[model samples]
Target: MNDLLDRLRGILLDTGYTIDGVRERLGAVAAAALSREETVPALRATAGDDPLGLLIRLWWLGAPVPARAAPVGLPVAELAAAGLVAVEDDLVTAAVHLQPWESGGYVVSDRKVRPGDPALRPDHVVGAGGASANLAQLASRRPVGRALDLGTGCGVQVLHLAGRAAEITATDVNPRALELARIGWALSGIEGIDAREGSLFEPVEGERFDLIVSNPPFVISPAGRFTYRESGFSADGFCRDLVRLAPRHLSSGGTCHLLANWLHVRGEDWRDRVGGWLTGTGCDGWVVQRDVQDPAQYVELWLRDAAEQGTPRYRGLYDEWLGWFEAEGVTGVGFGWITLHDSGSLDPVVRVEEYGGQVELPVGEYVDEVLGAVAVAHRMSDAALLASRPVLAAGVLEERIGPPGAEDPARIVLRQTRGLRRSVRVGTVEAALAGVCDGDYPLGPLLDAIAELTGEDPSDLRERAPQALRPLIAEGFFHISTG
Candidate 1:
């Protein structure tokens, strides 16, 4: 099988059939095979002697999958050919293509179950999924000496770490997953990863890393049928355990990055629930809940994961999931990213940032900047004070939120009657301008100008400037111009 896999991988590379192309073509072949016996030959030809594709075709022949069933034994070379992936180098590869699909709620990677198809095997090693890729790309790209990818699925995050860090280790509890991760590593040409087999930190205990990362098995399941995606705990115990244990394996100044889900238990704040995981760890942590889904939506999404459509199994699974949520008093589920830093601080900063609204900027870069802000906030004495020095000149407009239930509703508009028509939220005179500014003047001068224009007291304006600038500064609408 290995030899066959190797040969098929070579052919796929030479032929330039992308992973997506393979999936689409394979799915097309499989669909045809189920509907008509003549299509089996073409499907087999697509696999050629590739064990993974062969496995996928066998199942598709038996029953038409929902197109969401995971693909089995995907060839890396094929994925590269698909333009969905890029070969980073002789060492360290990445999946740069998952972002666009991820935004649309699809995991466009070699490692996904065929879209809308369910007969494919669950453990099939495909390209890195969207969530895994998202966490990896958003991981700090700064230089680090050592890094660990916890729950290294297909070694996607490990691949992202190869060049950024001097040494890398990718760990997983599933041996099959470890092998697949190795295969991905080999395909990516990344080396030096100690592919250890263990759940979370067990394999890397006593060995600390400058960076520890994971996109763990966080889907709370009644029965953990899928080892790679689903967690053992019915109440998201896997994530809690990972959070609690991650601090122990970090080096001083080390950072742990991950994407996870937590149940929003009734009568319990999500922030407090996650904060509990960081307790006793002494690590500064930032947990952002990107969105919350009701139990019904959660069940439907997971059911769609296996391509189970209108099946009694789905109903039973939904009941079980709801039962688990109900029994635990969970009203919703919070999904987001967690970042922990073991930088050795007397008072670790723990913040739960919420981002449920629509965002205009590219989210990955925004996530990176926020992380950088966290790092800066830790080091700086007064962020507001530092921001006042040499600000840029950016025009900001104040758009009114609709007037409260008035007969004639007000227009929500950005009225930028000055410099650049940049829509930024700036409160008051100086602070509003300063918040929307591109760092053109001194904080003192900006406040002075605002006081002069708005008839506010200068001292009072100066005092209020920082508060107004906080929101604008957080958003990149106000950038510090180094020129």
Candidate 2:
């Protein structure tokens, strides 16, 4: 089996069937179209005598290929025997979807059971998608002793954890997903992963990991509809329980990273709701709510995600799911990443805020940096924070704006050119402080210097400087010399 996989990989590489190769072959327009789940452009681009093209069309795009036309170096018979491909009549069709996923090499998962089909099978397996991709980007790549991927569908996270973690464990409730993930690990040549079958935290009971990552079945459903997504749990209960239980499963300084959806109930603040879950969890949290949708919009969005919006049973299913939300008194659903750090500090802080917009991925290092900033701010007294030397982050840029014909700028904006792409408008003191933060001096002395120059009261300057700087440190705009 290993030899067969090696040969298969050799064939894929030699024929230029990798991600970059495919993207180069199909231009940006076709690639974008494929990302939207439209296969027409990809089909048109890959239709040729090109070996890689044919294989891509057959294996990835779900187009059937003549049996005799199987690419060279791929053992068609062996793959068929392995149940990866099915031969019917004179044509061969792939039983699984194989794509060039990142993390050392490609990953495999079940293809859509039937494209354009309204209803999904209960055992359907979710693949490497936007959610998983975002979660990977959000995961820190720091080396760890033990790592766990909860609900590891198709082994995408397991494949990612291969080199970074000394020991890796992957779990899932669906046995078929585990089976597919085992096959994926084998094909990708990733080993040492202890794949187990269970729901969130059940299989790994009493064992703590240095890092835990989950892009779990987080979709809020009417009931458990698809095995890949629905948890059969109550509204967002899986997410809530996962967050609440993470602290118990984390070693000191460990982290539990998750992608989730939380309900915004009537007469309740969203931040308070999310913050309430973190209470007694013994972990400092950084929650970034990327988006929010009303009940109807949430139902419609997920219905479309499941590819059921335009089908014959769309109305009935939509009504049923919407009814569930209505009965639950959910006003909106919030989608985002929850980053937890188990620093074991008694006074743990939970930063709950919404950061909406496009930011760079795998901001894992940035995420870690934010946690460090939080810890530093927590440990330092007001005087110590003001006494620390500060430098502007590398990506920060300043923008001054004013109404037309004005000699002086009316407002100043400090924006990050990379990593989170954060931007904020600042007042005179902050703008002045930003211009001089070259790491040459401590913030306290800097503010004193500014007061000397501006004739403001030093007491007032000292009082407000740390408050303005604290957020910048936490958000990565300012890098302080912690050592």
Off by over 4 Å in 1: 1-8, 19-127, 279-281, 310-312, 343-345, 357-368, 374-387, 390-424, 430-432, 435-440, 475-483
Instruction: Give candidate 2's whole-model lDDT.
Output: 0.85
| Candidate models: Cα lDDT each | 0.61, 0.85
Candidate 2 lDDT, 297-377, residue by residue in tens: 988777876788668888999899888888888899999999899988888988889989788766886788888887776
lDDT of 1 by residue, 1-483 (tens): 335435544544443344454456566656455334255555555554343443334322222222222234444455456433344432213332121122211122333343344553555444455576568655776789988888876666765577678988888887767765565455444557788888767897788888888888888767777767776765788999888888888888788888889988878888888878887788878787888899888888877766675665767778887887788788888898888887677777676767654443334334545544454444433434544453433344446555687663244333333321235433445335645455555566666776787788988766765555544444433444323
Write down the TM-score for model 2.
Answer: 0.95
- Alpha-carbon deviation at 72 in model 2, angstroms: 2.2
Cα TM-score of candidate 1: 0.70
> Highest TM-score, which number?
2
Please state the error at residue 9 of candidate 2 in Å: 2.7
